[model samples]
Target: MMNILLLYISPGKTTEKISKALSDRFEADGHRVTRLNIGKPGSRTFKEVGSSIFYDMDLIGIGNPVFHLRVMHPLTEFLDQALPYAKPRFGAFLYLTYGGISSGRALLDLSNQLKKNNIPILGGFKVWAPHFYNRVEYPDIEARKTIDEFYSRIKESGYQPLEDEKTKRLFSYQTRKVNIAYHLANVIGNLRELPIQFDQDKCRGCNRCVNECPVGALTMQKIPVRDTSKCVYCYHCAAVCPHGAVICPTEKVADMVRTNKKLIGVENPQNAVYL
Candidate 1:
């Protein structure tokens, strides 16, 4: 049995559901899995990537969500610090979950990034998941089919990188259409950070937001004080607040959800499996 490293960046937990589904399949096939959320504070992505432990891993599967039409990981930065220690045979795959009906360039963007770091991407799996954190519609009927097919193809190939032509066709995730909104958001985000307003009076000092922040952007001082620079604007703080103390733009969130829901299952190739 091989030792598999399944890493993900999930603020809403839907991507985690997708990773869990794959982990289940891998474990049932007698492989040992070490699943980690690299976005979380203590679980640094470079720690594993830079260590000898990563060199020993039989398979590395990285999962991420598409935000603003791009992959949510700062992997190129992390890999810069970690690639010096890495050896050959970088057996790996990609998993992407997008709130929008279309993933745009999310998968291909990441695939190209990893290739630049000299990591051989064996496969990629893409799924259309719910945009909201409260929803649990991941690994749905379509996602399940792709997950099963992806795992089966990998196992049959003996976990090696599949042929170049096949890999290019499936895992590349190519498309001519560009998302102008995504491009605008990317530029806007660089200039300004999203505001997370807190209502101290309503706060009961439960500390849920502080503890649950994926990037540890919040600290408890009187109430939860935020480091705007560190926050990724997941709005998870507002979702987890028990007392409604964490205030965010509810209407914007609703509009994004409504827009995404209306476009569900409309993308020509919403869910994809690469072998």
Candidate 2:
């Protein structure tokens, strides 16, 4: 049995679901699994997490939900800071959950980083899940079958390096045009900052937003004030507020939701690609 570390950052809980599924499957196969959700507030720091790393671990599974056609900020931060502390030559697999705006360059970007760290990339899995802006059913039968097959193959063959031809094909689908367009859109959206404004009348001075902020961007004053520079815009503060006291870019987000739904359509049996 292998010792495995399943590390991921999931704000909307889609990637968390996938990570849990993987952990359950690995444990069922008699492998020891340590699952960490690094996106939560007050979670372990990169140094703390790296210090606890088991050098004897057989495989590490790193996953995250794609945002703006790239890995989310917190997961990217983890990779940059903590991944190098892992023992050299440890096998690792990359998995991504994306809202239907094309996986774009997310997988390739992560694979390059892992290679630089001398971590072997066994394979990659890209699954489509509900968009954070709009809810939709996901991890349907086909997606589950793909996940099962992926785990089964890994169990049987240990870590199989993805072939050059397959990698080329996968990368080919992410066009330069799409990259430029998505990145431009992301820049414009982020420039707005989309700070969560607290309603003074509604806020009960509970400080839930301040407490739940993963980046410590929110602080309780007369109302919850945000430090835009420190915020990664994970939307946790907005989501966790109980009194609907926080307001974000609702019109822009709603427009995005409508656009994505129009582009991908809210169909059953969501699509996924495995490499």
Candidate 3:
């Protein structure tokens, strides 16, 4: 049986859900699977995760919630640290849960990184998730099939490196058309920012946001205070908070999403597996 590792940063749990599904499928096929949620606050450092677990892993799957079409820290740092040890037959796949504005350059960016280390790019999967703070169905029937298809590629005795165009195409049909969005997202990524606010009245002195931040950007002194300098816009704080205390700029983001959705003619959500 092949040893598989799924290391992911899931700020909103959708990516976490997808990773677990993939893990379950890998185990069902009799492959040994090790899954890690490195997105959680207090989770093991990237260097620590890379030094021990990656050595024995035959295949690695990296999952992330695409923010502004990019991968964020913890995942970025973990992969960077793991690169020096990459070896032949150490295959890799990427599974992205995106809010659907655009998967952006995330797949292309990471695929290039792994290719530089000579890791075989087995496949890539993209799933449309509910937009932020709005209810949307995910991992639907089509999405489930995409998951299975990606696994079939892993079972192919030999892995192949993807062509430049095909690798970037994993950004999704919608993401490719919106080239401007990628540039806009790149600008936001540089800021290390999030458009969210906390209400002191509704906070209830809870430290959930502080404790759950992937980068420790939030601190609580009876209530939460965010340091935008450290925030990567993973949106975990609001997702974990029980009270309607964390006020994200949902309308602002949704408006932009709507404009982008219309541009791509997205009527219903879709999922795909890119080989």
lDDT, residue 198, model 2 = 82
Q: Rate the local accuracy (lDDT) of all candidates.
A: 0.72, 0.70, 0.72
lDDT of 3 by residue, 106-199 (tens): 7778887887777877778788777546766656676678788877875673556566667666544565455776665455444434368888
lDDT accuracy of residue 222 in candidate 3: 69
Model 2's lDDT to the true fold? 0.70
lDDT by residue (tens digit), candidate 2, 180-202: 64665565446535656789999
Instruction: Tell me the alpha-carbon RMSD of every candidate.
Output: 3.3, 3.3, 3.4
Candidate number with greatest TM-score = 1
As a TM-score, model 3 comes out at 0.83
Model 1 residue runs over 4 Å out of place are 45-50, 73-76, 88-90, 163-174, 179-181, 184-195, 257-266
- For model 3, what is the C-alpha lDDT against the true structure? 0.72
TM-score of each: 0.84, 0.83, 0.83
Off by over 4 Å in 2: 88-90, 133-142, 163-172, 191-195, 249-251, 260-270
